[model samples]
Each structure stands twice: as C-alpha cells, then as structure tokens.
Target: EPEVTQTPSHQVTQMGQEVILRCVPISNHLYFYWYRQILGQKVEFLVSFYNNEISEKSEIFDDQFSVERPDGSNFTLKIRSTKLEDSAMYFCASRTGLNTEAFFGQGTRLTVV
Candidate 1:
C-alpha cells in the first residue's frame, strides 16, 4: 500500500524553540487532519483542514500551532513555542470521509528537551 511520508521522523529540541513537522498526505484524499498521542494517551485531534483553510480545530490547537499545505504534496504543522507537554507522537492523516477511517502516517515524534 502507498504510505504518507514524514520528514525528520524524530526531533529533539529545547523547550521554547519552534518546530515544524512535515507530512505528505494521500494524494487522492479530500480531508486532512492532525492528531497527537501524548505518551500512552488516546489520539487527540488537533485540527482538520480542507478547501485551503481550516475546517475545524480542537482546544489543543491553540495560538502556538498552525498548519499549512505548502505545496502539491506537503502539509506542515508549526509550533511557535515548544513545551515539555508537547513531547508526543504527532500523526498526520487523510480520509475521504470526515468521520470515518483515516490513513495515518507513522508519525513524527517531537521531543522537547
């Protein structure tokens, strides 16, 4: 099966630095979403985007975080200031349906040092 690719699969940085996680969602899908798993916690939705703008976002997607589709195949999430609580597996997923099964990338592990 085809897979979504992410760059810098793992990153470690000091706690106040900025970080951008990159992903290439499935080419044919219509909906894009960002989710994170903090340690062993359940996957939590951060945001969803479509039609070139944000469609929805959760409380976790606060002022510090933003997302964009920089090119034909790249989607990125930028965190203006990292926190220790930000250490988690950030996953990028895309689906044809808004509330159905989604294909998830292996994830970019962000570690706040």
Candidate 2:
C-alpha cells in the first residue's frame, strides 16, 4: 500500500518566521495537493500541482506561499513570512488520477506565537 509521508509532525515558530513543510507521495501518483485545517475550522484546499507547474490554487496561496519539488520524490511548501492566521495542520495529498481516491499524509501541525 502506498501512502504520503510528512516530516516534522509538529512545528513551533515565531509569528514573523518562515517555515517549510515537506511531503513525499506514492511513487506512481501524478496529482499532488496541499490542504490545511486551522484549529476549529474546516479543511481548506490551498493548492494543486501537476506536471511541475501549479494546476490550481486558492486565494489562501498568495505571495507569501510557494510550492516546489526540489527532487522528483519530495514536494515542499514554503511560507515566506508566517502570521498567527497561518497556524494550521497542513496536509499533503496525492492520487493516481482525477477519479482515484486521494491519499493524505499525517498532517504537520504548525503553531505560531
């Protein structure tokens, strides 16, 4: 069985600092996405990437945020400057196709002080 894996299960940072969250998806999956859930809030889609380019993105993925696959196996999300509102559980997901079931990584819980 294939699954997504995330590093640093928990992170604590200052309000103005930067953070990079990492994920590794199943080897054969093509579609990758980043989603987040703020404490007490609903899960929200942040962005989707395919073919090495951004396929879709929510307003939440503004100038402060970026995603990249530095290596073929690792996907990363970088936040240039964190804010209190940026604190959330960030999840990485991937699927083989549009109709396939997406697999999500154990979310990385980020806390900003």
Candidate 3:
C-alpha cells in the first residue's frame, strides 16, 4: 500500500532557527493536513490544504508557519521562526474524504533548544 513518508525521524534545532518538516502523502489522496502533539498534550490541528491552497488552518498555524506542495509527491511545512514551544511531534496526514480516515506519517519529532 502507498503510504505517507516523513523525513528525519527526529530533528534538533536552535530556538530561533528555521526548520522544514517534510512528507510525501499517499497517492490518489486529495486533502493534506498538519497536526502536532506536545509531549503529553492532545493532538492539535495546524492546517489543511486542498487543491494547492489552504482549506483550513487552526490558530496554532500563526505567521511563522507555511505549507507547500513543491512537486507531484512532496509536501512540506516550514517554520520561519522556531520557538521552544514548537518542540513537538509534527504529523503529516492525508485523506480522500472531507471527513474521514487520515493516514499519518509516523511523525517528525522536532526539538527546539
């Protein structure tokens, strides 16, 4: 089965640097989303994109964040300015339905110091 793939299983960055988390969503899927979970906190939605534009975004997706599909298979989330609070497991997901099962990439653990 085709699956979403995220790189750098873990990332360590300085508090003020930029970081780009990457993913390759499942083929034939239409919607893409980004969600994160603090060490022990609930999973929070960051943003969702469809047809190359943002479909929805949560408050957590502030000015510092952006998403893009640079190629037929690659999707990425870039944090312009990282913060200590940004340390979390960032998950990339994709689903075909507007509201349905989202296949999650294992996750890219980002740690800001």
Q: What would the per-residue lDDT of candidate 2 be over residues 28-68, giving only the tens digit for each residue? A: 99999999999889999999999999999999999999999
List of clashing residue pairs for candidate 2: none
Candidate 1 ranges with C-alpha deviation above 4 Å: none
Q: TM-scores of the models, in the given order? A: 0.94, 0.98, 0.97
State the lDDT of candidate 3 residue by residue for 1-88, as single tens digits: 8889999799999998999999999988999999999999999999999999999999999999999999968899999999999999
Instruction: Summing lDDT over every window of 10 consecutive residues in candidate 2, give the lowest-scoring window.
Output: 1-10
Query: What TM value does model 1 have?
Result: 0.94
Considering TM-score, which of the candidate structures 2 and 3 is the better prediction for this target? 2
- State each model's CA lDDT, in order: 0.92, 0.96, 0.95
After superposition on all C-alphas, the RMSD of every candidate to the true structure, in Å, is 1.2, 0.6, 0.8
TM-score of 3: 0.97
Better of 1 and 2 by TM-score: 2
TM-score, candidate number 2: 0.98
